[model samples]
Target: MGAAGQPWSYIQRFPTEAGVPRTYELPVAAFQPVGMRMDPAPQAPAALDPSIITEVSVFILDKQQGPFAITITGIDAES
Candidate 1:
């Protein structure tokens, strides 16, 4: 969960296919900050700092007891 040796700063969870392979595009603004909401009122999340994102991870939450495989074809930073 750490990025570039720094504590997890942002995260986003989404559903994905079990076996089928596909690509996912994540915009910079889509990731929410990781922490308690200090503000009592709702507010928009801050933009993610792409420079600090030195790594990318894909975690499978399926609880089936067996070996699992996940293939990440590529990771790109787009404007």
Candidate 2:
């Protein structure tokens, strides 16, 4: 069975002198498919400088349930 609470927001930061790269992973528990009440939607970072972002990838795993993984590649200002 699914969890009760809404999915949690995942955030990771790669600190750099110039600018830090960041990645976020949101689990399936975060959202309700449909015909169901979804707690609070996961929130991503506010405004992120596009220049620092070199690449971004999103992956979804559907086995017993649903799981999502997101990876972001960038160069921090410090670098």
How many pairs collide in each candidate, listed in order?
Answer: 0, 10
User: Tens digit of lDDT per residue, candidate 1, span 1-79?
Assistant: 2256443356676767678888877777777666432222123236677766766656565567978877777777786
User: What's each prediction's TM-score?
Assistant: 0.62, 0.21
Candidate 2 TM-score, true structure as reference: 0.21
Where model 1 places Cα greater than 4 Å from the true spot, the runs are 1-6, 35-45, 62-64
Count of clashes in candidate 2: 10
Model 2 per-residue lDDT at 75:
28
The model with the greatest TM-score is: 1
Q: What is the lDDT of residue 47 in candidate 2?
A: 32
* Candidate 2 per-residue lDDT over residues 1-79, each given as its tens digit: 1223423332232222324344434332332232123233335233333343443333232334544343446423332
- Residue pairs in steric clash, candidate 2? 7-30, 17-77, 17-78, 18-76, 18-77, 18-78, 18-79, 19-76, 19-77, 19-78
